[model samples]
Target chain A: MESQIPRSKSQLPIPDYQSSNSATLKVDRVTKRYGSGATEVTAVQEVSLTVAAGEIVLIRGPSGSGKTTLLSMLGALLKPTEGTIRLDGTTLSELAENRLPDIRLRQFGFIFQDFNLLSALTALENVALVAALAGAKGKEARKRAAGLMTDLGLKERLNFLPEKLSGGEKQRVAIARALVNDPAIILADEPTANLDSKIGHEIMRLLRRIAKEQNRSVVIVSHDQRIKDIADRVLWLEDGQFKEMVTMATDPVCGMAVEREKAAAQLELDGVTYYFCSRGCRAEFEAERRGQVVGDRLTLQVGRP
Target chain B: MILVAFRNLFQNKIRLVISVGGVALALLLILALDAVFSGVEQQVTAYIDYSGADVFVSQEGVRNMHMASSALSASVASKVKAVSGVASVTPILYVTNVVVADEERNLAYIIGLPPNAAMGGPWRVVAGERIPSDGEAIIDAGVAEKSGIGLGDEVKILGEEFTVAGLSDGTATLINSVAFISKRDFAKLRGDPGTVSYLLVKVEPGGSPERVAARIEAQVSEVTAQTRPAFAAQERRVIKDMSTDVIAIMNLTGFLIGMAVMALTVYTATLSRRAEYGVLKALGARNGHLYRTVLAQALISVALGFGLGLAFTLLLAAIVPQLGTNLSLLISGASLVKVSLVSLVIAAFSAILPIRQIAGLDPAMVFRGK
Candidate 1:
C-alpha cells in the first residue's frame, strides 16, 4: 500500500524566498532507529527539509527532539534507516561507509558545542589539519587556515591551544577550521551552548554573515532561542517530529526564549522592544548600553528566570 | 600526521619521561645481563687466544680445557717437537687449588709452564720477571689486586709457600684466577713429575695451524690436537653451556618487562586522547592514519630508550672492572644490533592495543556535549 506523503521539499509548501534552485542540502523523509523489535526506538522520523545556498536554516527544539540525530544524519556521520540525504547533489545513503568520509571531507563542515579542537594542537594547526586532510599541501593549508583565522578576528590567537583560549576565541577557531576547506554546507550542533549569550550571539552573527556573504549554506541545531533572529528560516521539532514553523525572540543577555507578552523585563532599543527572560538579563543588557563593564557574575544571574 | 603524534606524546611531559624511562630500564637490564655473559665468555677464551701456540695437544677425549682434565707423559713434549710442522713444544700442568695469603683463601688455577718455554706463558708482565722459578709464582693482576699480594709476597699453594715473582695482566679465566709457576714445583706438589696436563705446540713460520694440528695428532696417537681458535671456541662453548639457562631466563624476563612497560604507556596515552582521536576521525581521518600516529609514538620512545640503554651499558663496562669483581661486561656492536631489533619488535607489538582502541572509537561521539 503506497500512501501519499510529502517526501521532498518540492511536495511541501515553502516560502518563495527559500525556494531557490541552488539547494546545497536535501533531506527526504529521513527516519533513524535504534535497537530491535520491542526495544526499537526511533530517534528521528519522516523528516524532510531543504537548505539552499546563501541560506541559514535553524532547527529549534527541546531536548530529545531528534535535532542532533537529524543533524548527524545530514552530515553523514549517521545513516538514516529509511530515507536519503543529498549534499551537493550526491546521495549519501547509497555510498559505502568507507567512501562516505571522502564526501564528508570535501562537502561538509561540522562545528560542535564544545568547540572540539585538538587539545594538543595550536589554533592554526587545528584549522590547517582539515585542509591537509582535504588534500591541500601543508604550506597552502596553513596559509588558508591563517587567512580564515585572520578573517574571523582570531589572528592574534593563532598559536594558542584550545585550553588556553577563552570560550569565544575557541569557537571562533572552530569556525575558522570549518571554513578552511571551503565546504559546501556547514553543520553546527549547539555551537553556542557553552558560551555567554553575548559571545553566542556574536558567533551566530558570524555564521549568518558567512551564509549571506560567502553564499555557503549553514544548518544549526540548537535549543538556544537567542540565535533564532539571524536565521533565514526556523523549524521547530518535538518528540522526533517536525511540529511547526514558528518565530520567537530570545533574550540577548541570557539566550532564553522570551514571550513578548509575558517577558519580565523589556526595553525599547532603536524603536524595537527587546524582550528579556529575567531582570538579570535586562540589567546586563542595560549595563552594556550604558558603557559599563559587565562581569561574568552579572551574566550568571541570567538563570534567575 | 607525524607532527600531531609527536605533539600528543610530548603534551604530557611527565608521561613522556616515564614511558621512555621504563623502556630504558628494561633495555638496561637486558644489555647488562648479555654483556656480563659475553665478558665471561671472552675472559675464559683469552688464555687460549694469547697462548701464541699454533696448536694444542690434549688427552684423547678432552674437548674443553676448563671442564675436563687432560694428562700426558712429559716425555711426549720431545716427540711432539719432532713432528713435521712443530717448531717448539711446551709442556704444562694445571691444578685447581686454594691459595692462602694474609689469612684469605682464594680459588686459583695453578698453571705450571716449563721455566724456559718461549710460548704459552704470560704475555704482559706488569712487574718483576715474566717466568717464575721453582719456588716462585706469577699472579694475575686481578688476583694480586684482590688478594693484596704484591711481588715478593709469600702465598701458600697446597700448604707450600711460594714467592710472587711477577704480576700478569688480563690472564683471569671464568673458573679461577691464574697463577703461573714452574712445572718442577707443580710435579712436586702432585707427586708425579713424569705426567703433564697438556702440550702447547708452536708451528713453523709458514705452517697452517689446522695442518700442523693434524700432523701432531697423527704422530701422537694418545692425544687429540686442535688449532688455537678451535680450542678457544671449545672453551667458550663449555662456559656458555654452564650459564646458558640463567642467561636465557634473564633475557626473557627483560623482554617481557620491556613489552609490558611499552604496552602500558602506549595504552594510557591512547586512552587519554581517545576524544581527540574521535575528533580527528570525525574530521575525515582514516583508521590507518590513527594507527600510524600511535606506531610513530612507540617508535620514537623505543629509539630514545635504546640509545640510553646503550650508554648505560658502556658505563657499566667501564666501572665493573675497577670494583674488584670477576664480572666482566662486553658491549659489542653485534649485541647492540640484536637488542635494537628486539626493541623495535616490542615497540611494534605495543602499538596493537592502542590501535584496536582507536579502531573501535565511534566518531559520532565527538558530537556529544559531554
Candidate 2:
C-alpha cells in the first residue's frame, strides 16, 4: 500500500538556526521552587548552561540536586520560577502551559529512564504511537516505526509487548520512539539508569555515535560517571548550578571545537542534514564526495556485535 | 481508538462480570414492579370488557364493586329497569369474607349473580360446573389453585357453609382473587337477604348507553347509573387513589436509587482509568469521540440489566398465582421498551460527568505518567 508518512525536511535533526548559531539551547539563570511561604523548597536555584548542535551534553548531579528539574524545564515539562530557556532561537519560559505540549511535540523527543513503553502495545506499536500523535497516517506510521525498529536491531521483537521484551530491548524501543518524529533535539533523562553496565555503556555509545554521525544534539541528565568519556562536554550540576565542562571533539568536517549549539555550517543529504563546526571542513567533505546519490537507505540496522 | 477501549474492558473479566451483575440486579427490581403494574391493569380492563352489561346502577356514592358495604336497597334494581330503553336488569350482590382451606384463612370475595342471570354469570369455567343454587358456588381457578380446594368441596365463608361446585377463569377483584355464588347466597352471607349491592342494566337493542344512563340517573333518587365501562373505571380509580402515594413513592425510590448506583460506578471507573484516557486524548480522539465511547458503555450495561431483570420478573409471574393476579407483572412489549429506554437515559446521563473529565484531559499527562 502507498504509505502516507509525513515527508520530513531533508535537513531535520540539524535544522538551520537562521543567524543565532552560538547556541542550540541556552539556560539563563533558571530557578524552580515547590510549595509556598514556610514550606517553600527550592529545587533548582540560579542554574545556567548552553549546548551547541551536534554536541552531547552530560548533566551530572545527585538525586536531589535538581537534575530532573533542569531537564524538565528544558523539555517544557515544568515552568521556571525565575529565568528563561531558549531552544534554537525561541524563548520557552514565556510559552503558556496549555501550549507547552505543542512545543514539546514539535521540537523535543523524550526518553525517560524507566523506558515507559505503553504496556498494551507492541514494540513497533510503541514507536508508531509517537508518529501517529504527530499526525502521521496509520499505515505510514506503522511502516516508519517498523523501519526504525529494524534499524535498532529489534526487527524480531517488533511485535512483542513491553513485558515480553528484555530491559535493554525495551530501552531500544523507547529510543526508536524518541527519534521517530525527527525532533530538533533529543532529551533523555537517566536513559541508562535501569540497565546493566554493559548495556548501559552500549546505550551511551549509541547516543554519542548518533550525535557525531547524524549531527543531532543529544542532552542526557545522568549521574552515571562511568559513561562520561562518551560525552563531547560534561557539565557538573551541583546544588542546581553548572560547575564545569570539557570539550572532547573537533568536527572532522570543520576546523572548530565541537559544541552542542554553535555549529558553523549544515549540509542536507538523503533527507537529513550533517552539521560541521567550520566552512573549511564542509569543503573537504564535498571534494571527497563520490557523487553517488546518498539514497533513502542510508541508515543501516544496528544489531549487537 | 475504540478498539483499545473495548479491549480494556475485557482485560479484567472479573470486574466486568461484577459490574454487569450489579446493573442486572438493579434493573430486575424496576422490571418486576413494571410487570406487576402491567398485569393488574390487564386483569382490570379484561374484566370490564367481558362484563357485557351496558349500564350499571348502584347507591348514589358507591364506587367499586368490591366495596359491597355500600349496597343500596333492592328497590334500586326495579327503578333502573323501569328507565326508558332498558331491556333487562340483573342485581349484583358482591361481598368479602375470610375463607379457610387448610387452616389458613385468606380474604376471599364472593360475586353473587341471579340463578339464571345472563348479564352477570361467570364468563369462563375451567373446572366442574357453575353455581346452581343458593348454597352452591363457583370458585376462581386461581383461588382454588392457591387453596388446593376442588369441586364439590364445602368451604365455610362468614359462618355460612357453601359447596364449591365449579372453577372459573379469572380471579376475585380485578386485583384480588374471588369465588362466585347465587345472588341469594350472597345476601345470606352478608346477613341482609333483601338488599342487593349493584344493579346491572342492559340497554334495549339499538339504544345508546349514555342516553339511558342519563335518564335513569334523573329518575332514581337513591341511585345513579353509568355505562359499564365508566363504572368499572371509577372502581379502579377509587382503588388506585387509596394507595397511589405509597405506590408512587416506592417506584420513585427504586428508580432514583438505581440511577445513583449506575452513575457512581461509571464515574469511578473513568477516574480510575484517567491515564488511559490521556492516551486517547493524545491520539487525537475529540470530545465527541470520547462522549460516544462512554455512552456506548453505559448503553450496553443498562440493556443487559434490563433483559435479565425482565426475564426474571416474567418467570416469577408465571410461577406465582398471587403475583399473576395482584401484582400485575404484565411485561407488555411497549412497557419493556419504555423501561429499558428509561434505564438507557439514566445510563447516558450518569456517564456525562466522566466523559467531561476525559474530554478535558491534558495530553502531556500521557508522557508525564501523572
Candidate 3:
C-alpha cells in the first residue's frame, strides 16, 4: 500500500506561526496524563503548535484520540502535565488558580459541541451573561449582546429561549455568545457536530469569517472534514500521539478526508477527479450531481469525549 | 447574574412548584406551631390580664392562683381597702370544678365575685347579661361553643344547678375555661360564707400600683401581695413550667422538618442544573458568581414560601376555631419576623451542597460534552 503519511514535516502545510510576527496562542511540548503507576493513562503527548492572529487551526482525530484533552489545555480549562501554554505572550501555566478565570474571561472564548447555552435564558440573555460575568452590566451588556446576535442573523430570535430555538439557530446563538466578549482567541470543540451539512458549513463559515474579520485566532477540535477547507492549518492525532498531517480532499457527501491513493471510489466531474472515503459517499455525491435532493445525514452521537 | 439565577429557578414549571411548595409546607408547619403556642400562652393568662386590678392579695406563701390553693377571710377586703393608696378592694374565690352541660362534663375554673364589684369579673361580654343573681353563671364563649351550650342553658356545677346568664370572649385557658358565679353561691358550696380565695385591689389616683402592692405586703400580716403584672407573670411562669418542654419539642420538630424539605428541594434543583453550572464555569464564571446564583435561587424560593406559609396560617386561624378544635392560632408581628429569619437561615444552609458542587466543578467537562 502507498504510504498515507506525508513524507516530510515541511510538506504538511502546517502554518509556520512560530516565525510569524503575531502569534496569539503558543503550546510548547504539552502533555496531559490522568492517573499514575499501574493505572496511568496519557491523554495527550508532547504536542507543540502555534496559532497566529487571524488564523484558524483545526485539530482532527477519532474517538479517544485526546482531541478534547488537548483543546481543554489550550483553553486554560485544564493544566498541561509537562508543558507550557501561552496566550498573547502570557504563560497560562504560571498563573495562580484564582487568576485563571480572569484570564479565561478576558482573553478566551469557547464554543462547545452541545451549544451549552443555559436553557433558562433567552438567546439574548445567554449571550449577555458572559459579558456580565466579565464586569459589563445592565444595558451595556445587552447592547453588545444584541449587536452580536444581529450580526449573526439571529436578531428576530433574540428573545426566544434555548428550547424555543432550532438546532442551527442555537449554534448561531452560541457563536454569538462566544464572540460577545471580543476575546483574543476562540477555542471550539466539535462546533458543527450537531448541525446538518448546510448548517454545519454555515457555522464553519461564521467561524472563518470571525477569524478573518475580527483578526482573532481560532482553534477547533473536530472530526468533521467539511470545515477543513476553512482552516489555515490542520493537525491530526491518533492514540494520544501526533500523527502525520495530511492535506487531502474531503468527500462532499459524508465530510470525511479521502487520500487519493487509497480512495474507495472516484469520479471525474468537469475534468476534475473527486475521491471518496466510501462507496456510499460516492453514490451520494453522484446523486447530488444528478440533481437529486439527499436529505441531511447529520446524526448526532451525544456524550462523546 | 441575578436575573439569570432567578430565570433558572422558573425554567421548569413543575420543579418550581414542587420546590416552592415544599418550602411553603415546611414554613407553614413552623409558623402554625409557633402561633398555636402563643395563643395558648395568651389564653393561659387571660383571667389575670383581663381583671383590670392594680394588686392581688393572696394567702401568704401563695405564688400563683392556678397552681396552689389559697384562702383568706372575706373581711380582709376591708383591711386591704384601709391601706394608704387603696382605692377599692374586692374579695374573689377561684376553684377548679367539673361542669355538666348537655350531659357532657367539662373542666372549668369557677370564680366567685361580689355582686357589684368593678374588678375580678368578665371584662368583655359577648352574649347575654353578666352574672346577676345567685345561682347564675357566666360561661366562656370558647367553652360554650365547644360543649354545644349557649345562653339560657342550665348547667350543673358541684351538684347544684345554675342558669347560664352570659358568655365571655377569650376567657378560656388550655387547662380550664372560666365560669363566673356569685359569692353567695360559692360560699354555700364551700360551707363557709366568710372565706375567700384572693383579694383584688385598685390603687387611688396619683398612687403607683407597685408602691401600693409593697405597702399592702407590709401592712397585711400572713398575706402576700403582688402587682397585677407581677401576678400575671407568676401565672405565665407556672404555665411555662407545666408545658414548656412539650411545646419546645414540637417547635424543634417543625424546624427540622422544614430544614430537611428545603435542603432536599434545593439539592435536587441544583443537581439537575449541574451541567449548566459547568457551562457557566467554562464561560469564565467565578466560584463567587456561581455561589451567588445558587443562593439567590434558594432565597427566592424561601421568600415565596414564607409568604405562602403566612397566608396559609392566617387562613387556618380563621377556620380552625370554627371546626371546634381547642387549638388557637395567634399570628403576631414578632412571630412573623422570627419565622422569616428562620426560613432565611434554612435557605442559606440549603445552598451549601449546591455551592460545593459548583465550586468543585471542572470547566473541562464542557469540552467533554457531558
Candidate 4:
C-alpha cells in the first residue's frame, strides 16, 4: 500500500526561524499513561515527531486516539510518562513545576474551540491580558494587542466584548491573542469545532498565513477534514501510535471512528461490514436489531494497539 | 492584575452587590452589638468616673463596689483625710438594694452621704438639689422618668420612706440606677455606729492621686486605697467579667456569620468565573498571581463592608438616644481595632477555598473544555 503520510505539495516556502532559539518543538518517543497496576491505561504510546518553525503539522486520529494528550505534552501542559519533549533548547520534563507556566507563556500560544476569551474584557483586553502576564506594561500590551488585532482585521471590534463578537470574529480575536505574544508555536485543539464550514475554512487559511509570515510553527489537533490541505504534514494516529496507513470506519452503534482492522467487533449485514469500538456497542446493536440480524458474518477480536 | 481583579467584579455586578451587602450587614450586627457593650461598660462605671474624688479608700479585700461590701472604720476615714496630699475625704455609705416609687420597683445603688458632703452626692443633679437631707432621696433622672416618679415623689429605700428631692443625670444603666440619701438616716436604719463603705478622697492641687492613694494605703489600716480611675476600672472589670461570655458568644456568632457571608460571596464569585480562570491559567498566569487577584477581591469586599458598617453604627449612635432607650451605643477606637483585625481575617480566609479551586485548575481545560 502507498503510504498515506501526506505532506503539503503547494510549493509554499517554509521559512526557518532557527535564528530565534524559540521556534522548534521536538518529541522523542513520548508516552503518556494514566492510573497504575491493574487499572493502568496507556493514552499515548511512544509517539515521536518533530515540529519545525514555519511548519504546520496536523495530527488526525480516531476518537480517543490520544491526539489531545500529545498536544498537551507538546505544549508543556502535561508531562510524558516516558521519553523526552524538548521545545527550543529546554527539556520540559526536567523543568520545575513552577517554571512551566512562564515557559508556556513565552513559548506556546493556545487557541481553543470555545474561543475562551474572558467574557468580562473587551476583545482587545482579552488579547492584551496574555501580554500583561508576561510583564508587558499596560500601554505596551494594549498597543501590541491592537497591532495584532488590526492585522487580523479586527480593529473595529477591539473594544467589543467576546459576547458581542460573532463566531468568526471571536475566532479571529483568538488568533490575534495567540499571536500577540509572538510565541514560538500555536497549539490549537479542535479550533474549528464551533464554527460553520466557511468560517472554519477561513480560520484554517488564517492559521496557514500566520505560520508562513510569522515563521512560527503550529501544531493543530483537529478532526475537521476541510482544514487538512493547510497542514504541512498529516500524521494518522491509531491506538496512540503513528500509523503508516489505515482506513477509518464509523461505529454504527456509537458513532465513533474506528480502524477496521483493530475494531473490537464487526458484523456483515446486507453485504456491508459494520465495525464497533467496543463489545458493549456491538451487543447493543445486536439487541436493537434482533429481528433483522440473522447475520451473514460476525467476528470478535482483541483490540489492537 | 488589579484591573483584572476589578473586572472580575464588574462582570457580575449583582453578585458584587450581594457580597458587599452581606458583609456589611454582618459587620453591622457586630458593631451595633459592640456599641451596646461599650455603653454598658461606661454606664456601669459612671458614678466612679464622674465622682470628684481623686482616690477611693475601701475596706481591704474589697477591690470594686459592684456586688461588693466594704466596711471601713470611721477612724480609717480620719486617717485618709490626714494623709499628705489629701485635700479632703468624704466618707459615704453605700448599698445595692431595691428602690420603689408609686409601686414601681427598680434596682438602685443607694448611697448615703453627710449634709453638705464635699463630693459624695450626685455629681450632676439635673432637676433638684445636690445633697439630700435626711428622708430626702436623689435618684437618677433616667430612672425617675422611666418609673414615672418626679421630684418630691415618695420612694422607699431599704424599707425607709424618703421624698425624692433631686434627679441625677447619667447615673442610670440597664442593670441598676444610683440614688443618694443622708448618712444619718443610713446609720440610723442600719444601726452601724462607726463604719463607712468608702472614703472619697480629693487630692490637693498638683498632687498625684496615685501617690496620694499609696500614702493613704500606708497611713491607714484595714483599707485598700486606689486612684479614682483605677477604682472605676475595677468596677468596669467586675461588670465586664459578669458579661464576658455573653458578649463573646454574640460577637463570635456575628463574626462567624460575617466571615461565612464573605466566604460564600467570594466563593460564588470565583466559581462563576472558573472558565476565565482556566483561561488565565492556560495563558500562563501563575497560581501566585491568581491567588493575589482573588485575595484582592476579597479584601475589597471586606474593606467596603467595614466602612459601611462603621457608618451605620455611627449613624445609630447619633440617633438612637433620641428615641429614648437606655441602650446608649457608641464606638471606641479599641473596638475599631478589634473589628479591623476580624475584617482582615475574613478577607484572608475568604480567599482560601477560591485559591484551592484555582490551584487545582488545569490549563488543559482551555483545550478540552468550552
Candidate 5:
C-alpha cells in the first residue's frame, strides 16, 4: 500500500503525505504460482503496490489470503512467476540466485510473527549477527546492536537468551535485528500477533516512530485489527488480490471503526482532528486534554453527520 | 554456521554420548581385530626372529621352514662351516607333528637339536636345559602350562614317550608349539640316518651376514643360504599369506560398520536440527557453509573415536600379557596407519548423506509450520 495509491476521505483523490520521498520498494502486478498442469496454485496474483520512504503500510487480511506470499515476494525471499519486484531501481526477480542473498541481507530486513530469534544466541548477539552478515566488523556490529537495543528499551536484557525473554522483548529484539542492517525496506509478517494488546500497540508505535525517523519503508501483514490506528495506510487483501481498502478513523473510546462522515463527536487535536463515536468520548477527550496543547482550530461538534 | 553446527551437535547430551560411543565401539572392533592379526604374525615367526643365527642354509630353493620340506645332504653343513665367514654351524632336523598327553593333543613343530650345538637349540629355555638329551624333550612353557604338564613329565612324540627336561618361552602360538628333541632320537624315529633339514650359521664379528650367506651358497651344493632377517621375514610372510583373506574380511566388516555408525550419528544430528539449518539458509548462508558444518562434525567424531579406540588398544596390549596366555596383542605401525585411513574414509562416507540433504534443502521450509 503505497501512499500514492488511490485512497481518499470521500472517494476524492488527495495528495499523499509522503509524495516528496521516492519509492524505496515497488511491486508491479506480481503473480506467484506453484506447481503446474492440474495442480497449479496461485498464491499471489497481480498484486501491485509501491511504498515510499518512511511510509508504513499495514496489509490486513484473513488467513490464507496471500498476505504472506505478497510479503515474501516484496522481501525478495520468493521470486514471482510473472511481473517484477524492484528495490530502488534494481529488479529483484531478474537477478541471479547468488545475488539474492546479499540483496536480502543488505537491502531488505525481515521480522517474523514468532520473533524467530535463534535460541542459542543472546538477545544482543541475535541483532549483531545480522549486521555481521552484511559485512560489518565484529566490534562495529556489536556496538550498533547494543545501541539499537538500548534505543529500543532493552538495555538490561541484552545478555538474555530468546527463551528467557518475554514476548514483548523478543519482538523488540527482532525489530532491532530488522533495523540493524539499515535496509531500505523492512517486511514484517504478523509481528504483533503473538503479543498482548498493550504491548502490541507499543510495538506498532515503535515501528511507526522508527520508520518515520529513519526514512525506511515498512510493510506489515497481520490479522490484528487493533493495530490500524498506528498505520498510516491500512490495505485489505483477499483471495490473492487487494480489495478497495477502508480509510478508517478509529474511535479511541470503544475502539470502533469511525469513518469521517459517521462520527458522533469530533475534537481537533493539534493539526489532525480526532473523531469520537459519542459525546461522552468527546467529553473524556476534552477532560483528558484540559490545559494541554490543543489544535488552533479546535472544532468541537456533536452530530451524527 | 560453524557455531550453529557445534550447538546442534552438542545440544543433546545423551545423543552426543551415544554417537561417540557408537564410533568408539566401531573403532574398537576394527583395531582389535587388526592388532590380533599383527600379534599372530609376530608370534608365528618368533623362532626365526629369536634364533641366534646370522645365516640359514636350507635345501635348495627353500626360503621358509613352515609347511615346506627342506632336506640337505649331511655334508652341506660341513661345507657351510668351512666358508670363510662362518664362525660355527649347527644342523637341525625339523618335522611338523603332534605332542600327546593323556587324551589331550595339540600340533607341534618337533625340532631336532645337535649335541653341544652352537645355534640350533631353544633360544630361551626358562628352565632346566636349552638342548634336550636323548629320550628327553624341551617343551614350550605356555603349552606345558595349558596341558597340565610339568618338568620331568612324560609326553608322547611320534608315538614314543620322552620326559620333559626344560620349559621354554616364546615358542608357542595359536597355530603350533615348538618341542625340542635330540637329533639322534629324531633320526631314529624318522629312520633317515643321514639328512639335515636346516643349517644355522653364526658369522664372526665385523662380518656381513648377507655376504657370508652368498659365499655359503657358492661353496655349498644343493643348498640355499639366506640372512636371518630375510628368512624371518619369509616365515612371517608365510603366516600372513595364509591368514590375509580371513583377516581382510574381518577388517572390512569392521570398517563398514564404523562408517555406518558414523553416518547414522551425523545424519541424526542433522535431521534433528533440520529446521535450524533451513533458517540459516533463509538467512542468506550459502550451501558451502552448511556442507562444511556437516563435514566438520563427522570428522570431529571420528577423531575423538580414533583417540578413544587407540587408548583401548594400548590398554589391551598392556593387560594381555598378564592373562598368562600365548595370545599376544601387538599394536603395530601398519595397524595404526590402516586404522587411520579407515577413519578418514569413515568420516568422508559419513558426511555424504547429510551434505546431500542440506544441498537439496529448500529455504522456504523455514516459513512453514511443522
Candidate 6:
C-alpha cells in the first residue's frame, strides 16, 4: 500500500507558475497624496512592482523611501491614488471596499518590523488568531500554532505575552503568524530590523527557508542590508522608483545569503566548524562557545556590521 | 480580530472605567427623571381609577377636582341625576379653610361626603372609623400626622367647630393630604348650607360612560360631564402646560449633556489609541475590523453605564423616602429599552469619524513613525 499511489500533476504540492499565472500581486504606477494644495504632499509616487508565485522579493529602501507603501499596495491595504493592484489576476482598484477584508483574510499574510502583536494576546494566541481568520477552527488553529511554534523553537514561550518576549522571539512569532494561512504571498515590512545581528540572520533564514520549502512568495520591505542576501531577488527603490534587481547568495554559517558581499559571522571553537558575519560577531561567538557549560547554549552580543 | 478587540478594551482599564462611570451617571439621571414622572402619572391615574365614577360632573371649564375656582352648587347634582342612564349622583363639596387648635393651625381642604351617598364617601380609611355624625370629621393620615391631630381632638374651622372621629388614607385635597368632614359640617363651615362643589355620577353598569357624559352635558345646562379617563388626560395636559418650558429646557439640557459625555468618551478612547489602531491596520487588520472593534468597545461601555444607572436610580428611590410613596422615580420597560438603544446609536455613530482616521492611516507613515 505504501507505493501504490500514482501522483497526478494537479495533486502535486509543488508551486507552479503556469497554473498560478494569475499574478498574485501587481502594483502599477501607484501614487498617493495627502491633504490639499499648499498643504499637500506626496507619500508614494509612481511605484510599480509585481510578485508572482514562488518568488521571494525584497523591497529595499531607507526611511521614507516608500518601501512600506509599495508593500501596502501589494497587500491590498491601501488604494493607489493613480494606479491599480491586481491580486490573483483581479485588479483590487475595481473591487468594492466591503470585499477588501475578505480578500486580505483569504489571500495574504502580513508581518511587521515592530512585530505588531496585540500585547493582550499570548504568542500562541496570536498565531492561532491568523489561523482562525484564515478559516481554521479555533481549537484546531491553536493546536497547529502550538506545533508550529514548537518547531520554531518557541515551545517554552507559547503562553508568554508579546511584552514578555525578546525581540528575536517576537519576530519568530510574527513569522509563525504570517505562515499560519500558507498564503500565496507573505508581506513583511522590515521583519528582522528589530533583532540583533545574530537573531536577525536567524529570522531571515527562516523566511527564506519557508519561501523555498513551502513555495510561497514573501515580499519584505527592509533597510536592513543584512537580509539582502537571503532574498531570492533584491528590488532596490529610490524615491518610489525601481532601481535594479539582483540575485542573492547564501551565508556559509546559517546557509542564508546576505547580498552586497555580506557574510554570516564565523567562529572557531574547540576544533569545531562555525561561522560569523564579522570579526566582532566571531569574537562574541567565540566567547559564548568557550563560556558555555555542557548542556546550555551560550549567547553573546553579536553586533550588526 | 474581535477577540483582539475585546483584549484592547480590557487593556485600557482607566479609560474604560471613566467611560463607564460617566455613562452610568447619565443613565441614572435619565432613569430617575423618568421614574418620578411615571410615578406621578400613575398616582394620578390610580386615584381616578379607584374613584369608581364613570363621569365627573363639574362646573363648565373646571380643570381638576380640588381647585377652589372650579365649584358648582349642590343643585347641579339633582339635575345631573335626572339624566338618562345616571344610576346615582352625589354632590362632593371641596373648600379650603384654616384649622385652629392649641396654637397649631394650617390651611387644609375640607371635603364633604353626602349622607347615604355611595358616590361621595371615603374609599379607604387607615384609622378609627368614617365620620359618624354632624360636627365629626375623618382626617387624612397625611394631614393628621402633620397637624398633630388625633381622635377626640377638637378643632375650630371657619367659625365652625368639629371633633376628629376617624382617619382616612389616600384622601387629600392637595396631593392626597386633605381632611374629610360630614356634608352638614362642610356646609356649616363654609357658611353656606344650600350649595356644594361638583358632582360624582355613577352610570348603570351597561351604559357607555362617554354616551352618558354627552347626554348629561346636553340635558344639564352650564355643567360639563367629563368621563374619568378623559379628565385624567386633561389633568396631565394641564400640568404639562404649566411646567412645559422648564421641563423642556431641562430635558434638552440633559440630552445635550448626555451626548457630549458619550462623544467625549468615544473621542478620547479613539484618540488615545490612535497609534495602536495604526499598528493594527499595518499588521493587516482591515478598516472594517478596526471599526467594529471600536464600536464594540463603546457598546460595552454604554451597556455597563446603563446597568449602573438603573441600579443607581433604584438606590436613590430607596435612600430618599420622598421618592418612594408619592414621588416615584419611574423606569418603564419602554424607557429602559429606549435609553439603551439611544446609547448604542450614539456609540455607533460617534465611532464613525474615529474609525475613518484608522482607515485613512498610511501604513508607510505609520511604520516609519512619520
DockQ scores of the candidates: 0.50, 0.12, 0.63, 0.50, 0.33, 0.29
lDDT of each: 0.81, 0.69, 0.81, 0.84, 0.80, 0.70
Show the lowest summed lDDT stretch of 10 residues, model 6 chain B.
B321-330
In order, the candidates keep a fraction of the true contacts of 0.60, 0.02, 0.86, 0.69, 0.24, 0.38
What TM-score number comes out for model 2? 0.69
> Once superposed on the true structure, which residue ranges of model 1 sit more than 4 Å away at CA?
A1-23, A247-305, B173-175, B218-222
lDDT for each residue of candidate 1 in A57-125, tens digit (9 for 90 to 100): 889888888888888788878899998898765899778999877777777778999899999999999
TM-score per model over all chains: 0.84, 0.69, 0.85, 0.83, 0.85, 0.76
Cα lDDT tens digits, model 1, B254-364, are 888989999999999999989989888887888888999999999988998888888898999999887777778998677788899989988999999999999999888
Order of all candidates by TM-score, from best down to worst? 5, 3, 1, 4, 6, 2
Candidate 1 chain A minimal-lDDT segment of 10 residues? A1-10
Between candidates 1 and 3, the TM-score winner: 3
Q: Which stretches of model 5 miss by more than 4 angstroms?
A: A1-23, A117-165, A168-182, A197-215, A246-297, A301-305
lDDT of 6 by residue, A64-97 (tens): 7667666766777677778887776688877876
Q: Is candidate 3 or candidate 4 better by TM-score?
A: 3
Per residue, candidate 3 scores C-alpha lDDT tens digits across B252-323 of 776677778778878888898899999988889999999999899889988988999899999999998777
Decoy 6 TM-score against native: 0.76
What residue runs in model 3 are displaced by over 4 Å at the alpha carbon? A1-23, A246-305, B126-129, B141-153, B173-175, B192-194, B324-327
Q: Residue-wise lDDT of candidate 4 within A1-305, one digit each (tens)?
A: 11122223332222222314347889999999999999998989998888888777788899889898888888888889999998877899778889999988888889988888888889999999889999999999999898778767787999998999999899889887877777899999888999998788678767776676676888888899755556666788878999964354556765544567767888766566787768888878877787675763445443543
Identify the runs in model 4 with alpha carbons over 4 angstroms from their true place: A1-22, A138-140, A150-159, A197-202, A244-305
Per-residue error for B233 in candidate 2, Å, reads 5.4
**Top candidate when judged by DockQ against the true structure:** 3
lDDT (10s digit) by residue, model 5, range A1-305:
21222222222111113322334788899999999999999988899988888787889887888888888778767899999988777999899988877887777777888888877778998888778777888889899999878878788999998989999899999888877777778788888889998788677766665666567788988888766655666788888899856555656655444545556887776667776668887887787677575653466767674
Candidate 2 lDDT for residue A297: 38
Weakest ten-residue segment in model 4 chain B by summed lDDT:
B361-370
- Which digits, one per residue and each the tens of the lDDT, describe model 3 over residues A38-63? 99999999998888887778899889
RMSD (CA, Å), candidate 4 to true, equals 12.5
